[model samples]
Target: MSVEATGETRSVVTAATIREILVERAGVDPDVFTGNELLSLAELQIDSLAVLELQAVLVERFGVEIPDESVTMTVGEIAAVANEDR
Candidate 1:
């Protein structure tokens, strides 16, 4: 399922989608992710700057607002939060 906001269509938030955004927007190596891994952002080596960029991408592409506390969550958890916002 997808969400439409401001006349833009956004994909249903998922771990794969978040991973793709990280890879595309933050230059994260796709090989470094397992999609379903229950690792925190720190474990994934995502720094504060990357988190900020990810937040921006999430808002722009998914129309999801990620809270400050969610920044340390796993990709899956973050995806869940975005999906909930939808």
Candidate 2:
């Protein structure tokens, strides 16, 4: 979603947005992403199927390409990469 920054507006790809996509599209638990902790997908209990789904949603929503080697990346890291691509 678009967020208002100080005199400069930008699109923000937040962890909450990722969590919502996981919950709504991938059937992940809402409680699983309770904080802004930087944890890997495995640490967040995301499975292989969920990872693929997450990647698809990221591409569709942000038009950002996440490399396959990023399986160990945290949500925050992924968001940072996506934001950079914006």
Candidate 3:
């Protein structure tokens, strides 16, 4: 296991990329993620398990760790977490 093999070589994590990961990997609606990035995942009825899966993808895909309180974080907040690590 190398970092490149784990897909952690990406230089950045953008909102669009996060949105794509949400839609493609986390089962979130494409349209849902676009509006009110301040709203928490719970507000959108996105379950904690889904968020955990999303967090996993963020690490495997971007090498960023989601906070333990991730389910309470908004989409923008989630992106910030990744960007912060970068």
Clashes of each: 0, 0, 0
lDDT of 3 at 83: 87
TM-score: which is higher, 2 or 3?
A: 3
lDDT of 1: 0.80
Give one digit per residue, the lDDT tens place, for model 1 in 1-86: 33354575557888888888888998888887765387788887878777888889988876788877665799889888888845
Clash count, candidate 3: 0
In angstroms, the error of model 2 at 83 is 1.2
Summarize candidate 2's per-residue lDDT along 6-73 as a digit string, tens digits.
45554588877777877999998888777736778788878878878888998887677776755588
Best candidate according to lDDT: 1
- Best TM-score goes to which candidate? 1
lDDT of each: 0.80, 0.75, 0.78
TM-score of each: 0.79, 0.75, 0.77
Give residue 2's lDDT in candidate 2 (0 to 100): 38
The lDDT of model 2 is 0.75
Better of 2 and 3 by lDDT: 3
- lDDT tens per residue, model 3, 1-86: 76668886656777677678778887887788666677888887788778888889888877788886877878778788888835
